[model samples]
Target: MSVSPFRIALIVDGEYISAWQYLMLERLLASPHAVLVVVIFRQSVATTLSQRLNAVLLKVLHALDGRFFSCKPTAQTPTSFLPLLGDVGCYAHGSKRYQTFVSTQRVDVAIELTGQAVLPEMVASTTHGVWRHFYGNPVHWWDDYTNIREYARRQDEIVSGVVRYMAGQAAADCVFYATTSTDKVSINRGVERTLWKMADFIPQRLHELATVGEALFQRNMRERVLARPLSSQDAVAPGLITTCRIALRYPSNFLRKLYKFLFRQEQWILLTTSHGNVTELGLLENFHKWIPPRDRFWADPFVVEQAGEQYIFFEELIYARGIGHLACVRLQPDGSHTEPVKILEKPYHLSYPFVFKHQGQYYLIPETAGNHTVEVYRCEEFPHRWVFEKNLMESVEAYDATLQEYDGRWWMFVSMRSHQSCSPNEALYLFHADDPLSTQWQAHPQNPVVASAAQARPAGRMFTDAEQLYRPSQNCAGVYGRGLNLNRITQLDQECYREEVVSSYLPDGDFDMNGMHTLGIGRGLSVSDAVYIHRRLGRLDHWIGKLSGFIDQLVWKHCYVLMVLPLTFLWLDM
Candidate 1:
């Protein structure tokens, strides 16, 4: 039997609508099992000089490019414009015309994307409920760390913009929420671009919102529900003096850049400790460093134990190639290691050599996403030679392809970046197959099961402790690979997927490490990698290294151009 779509209505601040908000509306219209019945746009009186300028610019653009560049109602659904002559919340709720329209449409739910507070009494008397979408720091408006100079200058603390959705009319009634960190580049581009970036995942989030809304409504009917008390963290608007000071200091960031160029070093270091010690301490202590030769680093370490012997596989990145290859080393019982050996190489960049054993056969699935394919290789000899096995997936940009077997199925968890995505590490995708090497893989109904950089990217191996399966994820909140998040997989299937974060490990010891991304354990030994700033050379060497790395990146980006240039010269000479 076919079920009816949820009838939804939007209450938006027409004065604030931009290209980004339009994109959100477009995505909502595209969602399955959801129908936008009516849109109510509340127009606010323009006060600021910037607001007045924007209004005039929008009018001119609309005259030239038509509705494409305008903030007016463009969706096919019915819409009504309401002018707010007084307080926005009180005017909206008290207007008889608005109330009549809501009654006529019979909206099952209402959503406010205006970032304005709606009274709880008004919301309860209206539709089933309302959801509010906030695009900046909800608790605090201005912070010293805001990505945009405008906001930073105005506020003393950094402005950490959040794309958040809160349920219920009151602030305390927020039941479901998701947050993504905004960088300076994104914030300076304005709200339209921010919304456009968020549009990639907001559609999926709306579906989740609908599901949660229905479930909460039913539960509310069965039992009395009370709103949680609001916390004391209130936001204060920024003053002009603070804003001017911040703007003046913004240009001085070049000094910090120069300092970083002079002294900053990013070197990947590997460490080993007892598994029990890691669980108890929540941080690794007393570790031995596995430092490679000059201008080379070892990372993404995977360990395999066989016949009382341990072998560690990692990605060895050399400065010249500017690409990584699968490398291995033998781990001795006395905690010493042998020299590293290159095991596998390809013309394209490769890293995250995820190795595992199945049916007594050793197989490897390194990140060949740069080549636009996911492939498996079989090790013919221990820790040295490997032959191409099969392509599990193709034409996809997937990273850190981690695999595990559960409930008689082979499941692969990877971070996928869509062509439209602004960041690659934020979206988590799943694929399952009956055979470990099967090419016929099925995507989860909810492909991007998680969409936050803080928890989506797979870091290393998945293991079971006390019958509970835990997956290690990268915490890319402040920076990529900043820490490790351990999540317990509570449910997994075609229709549904869920996981809860159990514990986290951060680099907080003597290493002065900035990041720890990978974690692997086998035969009572756990291996992890930490990133630290190492000043390896003086100023001259540093500049040379920088130039070399730049050239490598250029070569990687336009290898095809280099190939075509030689061919073109040969043809011209002939």
Candidate 2:
């Protein structure tokens, strides 16, 4: 094992690469702990005329739909000039020329961006062989697989991961995996968002290799699950029929957006009850409801009880402000509530007031992702006021950061966003420290420990039931906050982490419940929240907005969208 920086090889298609791949290269090259020792490029062969036409059509739609619907201006380009760094050898992989050049270089680890499985020869040439991205849910690691855009459009989600190919090993090592929601309106947007997030996979692994040393890194890699085996399949360009199907699906997409903007407003309300397993969604209708007015929504409820008095903390977002603020309300014995009081307000959006007790003192770490930091606040006055404590993390888009004490150490669980458009609901990261309020924390070697929309984001504080530690997670699969998953922590330590979903609590169809995320329990008081869909058809505050939104949709989709269709064909291959 060596503590020195790693000598890396960048293997890719020659001359040009996708913009997202270029981003990966930039991150890899920028790392002070990694040095680019050599590059092995495999030039792309020619494609059929139909394939070229398919690419052109995809380019036009991607440029238009991503920016138009997703409002992403800086979409990743399919083709970008590749930066030739270190000793470069643009030779066909596995060829005699490639073998000669690769053998001459002293490579620790190789990053393969050519969308190909690591060949046994390449694995033998390097110390740790190559790391590559594999796609699919159970992971379809096939030689010729469906394009991710088509897969996302068809499947409504994308799951991909990076794996380490160790020399002489039968199975590759799983380093990272993520299940991201697909932008149903725009397949290209979905692909763009997913790739931007997955770009960090290799760079993080490289960092571990450098700092943790090869022996521990390799051992930990093996401790995780093995990568899926690569299967063979025939792939081709999307032909006329597939293309027409894609075009036709947009009509429904337009209708869905129109329905949302015109007739509906996502009004999240909070539900609370005195007792029951809040993890179980049954009997929620019996719980009292805290509905907000049409102008805003109240959600993410965390009820705290002190000295026989209970206070409910939540996020209140007024429509005019378009940002969330921390607010709390005191619960009366007669099941009544006081007027909501603003507790802590910041210029940036804040939600998920993760309040917990540490050594007889109350501390709060809310989701301050808008400021790009996980900030901590200490409660000076019970239930209402707090002072700054410490910045636990910085310059990171971490969400719903929930901290818990386990194994005589403090652990923090959070969902992280790798890129701007990347969803934080897809990957859960773990960090630990000796002190609960410590600014410096050690990240778990295998992060994210779990990567699935069904169980990635922390729903609320971790609690124990029947002496078994349980953590609540949000199922943000098809819809945000669709349900809550109670996961039993099977393993948690400095080197490894694991959890199993013991039970799932989704909205009761009989209760007309739409979604839920947070759950609060302790002091003989248990509380959780649920959302019900409410149409703004009759509300006075939304009637005029409904009419205006209807017209806006018509004008934008029917007129503007149609007008740009022909222009996209003329935008040239991008």
**Top model number, lDDT:** 2
User: Mind giving the per-residue lDDT tens digits that candidate 2 earns over 419-484?
Assistant: 886787988999999998888888876777777777889988788877888888888876688888
TM-scores of all models?
0.70, 0.83
Off by over 4 Å in 1: 11-16, 48-101, 115-128, 137-176, 182-197, 209-213, 216-233, 241-245, 248-252, 278-284, 380-382, 387-396, 419-421, 430-452, 488-503, 536-574
Q: What is the RMSD of candidate 1?
A: 13.2
Shift in Å, residue 214, candidate 1: 2.6
Evaluated at residue 419, the lDDT of candidate 1 is 46
Q: Rate the local accuracy (lDDT) of all candidates.
A: 0.62, 0.72
Residue 26 in candidate 2, Cα distance off native in Å: 2.2
Candidate 1, lDDT over the whole model:
0.62
**Cα displacement (Å) at residue 221, model 1:** 17
